[model samples]
Target: EEATLLLRYGQWRLRGASPDPDELQILFELAAMGGNAQACLELGLLCAKIDRQGERIFMEHGLANFKKALHWLERAGEAGVAQGWHALARIYSRSIYSQRNLQVAQHYLEKAAQAGLVEAQCELAQVCWRHRRDDPLNDVKALYWWQQAAAQGEPTAQAALDAFAAQPDAQGWALQAQALLTDKLRNSSPFLSARIELAATFGLTKPEALLIDIKAADYGHCLVVDICAHHARSKRRLIAVQTEAQRATLNRVSRLFGDVDCGFDGLEGNYRQRQYRLRTTFPDLG
Candidate 1:
């Protein structure tokens, strides 16, 4: 219902940022009775959102409610709720609370993906990438998941693509990033289609100005790809980035490993080749 409301309004404002405390209490009362897992999840997310409202909670407030929300979200996830999987994934993906329960995070995200939640599909990719030190990234797989979400006209996925394409040499992280955008161009989303044409024109000149930007971005930034442990085919490509956010966009390079350690190397021609070699390899998880 919350998702539907947000979709209907064409914005989240329809649901307001915070749920009324009095209303939340009634929902909780209903949730406590039995198969009201939905209410439990809503109440949980409400409390969680409220707890984060450091400036809104008028009086009684602490981190307790935030923690309580997690408890309820977990219960709903256990009850096989798709929303619970996504909610739990959101909690786990946050750098703030992610470190708290990684294993649980993976569990919920996978469940969500199985339940056909595109948001959870995205989260599961992250969870899979973060599972170990050297999980391979197949940009194809990344594109696959992004395609699923983007096809639904999901703004977050579109935002992810906007952020992804903004990179100077986006191809270095994943051929699929380009493919993902291209797929959007071919099938749906006219905005991305126009974006593809712009990028092609930019690539034609092979402008060196983006080099300086890429160097600066690489200093402290990492590509936050929505990749799974897939060892797919490999390819040679160049990845140029401009902003920290674009650098942080989700992407996948097929079987290329160790990209995080590569500093500013040659920029003339083989930069993309070098990047591909240094990137994390996409394992043959199949």
Candidate 2:
């Protein structure tokens, strides 16, 4: 209960990353014993997402992790841990666990929703929306869960709500989400230099980003773009451009996507009249 409280109220922020190994061992042992499935699930995510002993060992060993994680989650689900059901739902939904059992996927996610996990609610809603809607999907239940998630102070939920609400203008909602995500992706990021490094590695002297699509869907703002580069001396530049509507969705894109090795070059330009180079790592040199 105390551990759950720590996680729920954000006290874990004070716990920091450098936890005592022995203490952490004891903590995990106790939590697993106590049927705190969230602890097991989170431990799995950490082990998978974080490096251990200079080796990235998570998904490579995910079969084992998921087994143990499911064990704890099933127990916690029976014991009425809301997040436990949520974990079980995620595992079942992911092919690693149940091997892509959509029926079970729906089952566990619905169970989690009944247990009041807003994240689960949003996910299940998307599933419902997908079955009923076409490209640029939407469903009433999906929108409801997004609203619920948004109201719970989940930034993702909020962004999603702004995307697909019943308003006449989904682009407007995307703009609202943009205002929320300004600080995370732009201005200060360690990966900021990584973008540049990629261009260097790919033999691209200059890369450009062209905004192809930015629109709100059933969940949140969706952004699609064509990025190009030129090693040619004459047209060596990167450009990114979007309509005002697209600019609003850009924030949504920044929040969800990390430094994907999509071969992105850089922000060549913004808004209309933006200048962008065309493709080719060796343009004029060739």
Candidate 3:
């Protein structure tokens, strides 16, 4: 009951015409010490603010304030407040904080989203999309978070979902390629097999897969298949690496072709020779 009275007085002070920050801080701290989760959250938020003084005040006292904020927010999060985790994520992501850490921010953001915070879900989706080039699995993760937010009636997430749906689907091409390339035939020619698997994974055509340079084509987030130099009729195209399986296949194929020179006079020979080898290895491909 003492804790409740302290919290009430703190809230009352906040609602006053001109509240005393020192009094409110003391009241919230007393309540928070009495095991009040809401007090902890409120105290954390209060500590995180820099007031109107800006960088000068921050330089003098902001570090200690940030540390206190993290401590109280972590306590609130441990007490099952999803917004506490989200608040921590914000502080960790901002440059003003001396303890800024993107990796830690991502971890907390993910925790808040998983705990059913809609704002966290939306923000996490955007973060995943922005860093998709670092890890192709981020595309899949972004889609998942957007879907989660959209299900909760978030308009921006709904719009993003619609946009994702409008992009070209590559499942059909993947299925067709899967039907033609069997494990036995793929194993017959290790080099050709790797190319075929990679093509099927990213919806690449025969010419693009066989002639394109694996190392040169990989642009982290997407594959830039440009075989126009070897096959005049083929135009350069980009296929996004959206799935974990696609990333795995791409990594495997990249390692396979790492040492081998993929040129006209290389061990693999020209495009025609590679094509001939494929047909000879798999008689049914005719």
Q: Pick by lDDT: which candidate is best?
A: 3
Name the regions of candidate 3 deviating beyond 4 angstroms: 50-64, 166-286
Give me the displacement of residue 52 in model 2, in angstroms.
Answer: 16
Q: Sorted by TM-score, highest first, which candidate order results?
A: 3, 1, 2
The candidate that wins on TM-score is: 3
Please provide, for model 2 over 76-192, each residue's C-alpha lDDT reduced to its tens digit, 9 standing for 90 to 100.
Answer: 677777666665665565654446677776788888787778778778767876774353333555656666666677787667555432221323322232233344444543233
RMSD of each: 15.4, 18.1, 8.2
What root-mean-square deviation over C-alphas does model 3 reach? 8.2
Give the per-residue lDDT digits (tens) of candidate 3, residues 149-218.
9879999988877654412235344345456777776676677778767766776667776788998878
Write the number of the candidate with greater TM-score, choosing between 2 and 3.
Answer: 3
Question: Cα lDDT of all candidates, in order?
Answer: 0.45, 0.45, 0.77
TM-score of each: 0.40, 0.40, 0.55
For model 1, state the Cα shift of residue 148 in Å. 2.3
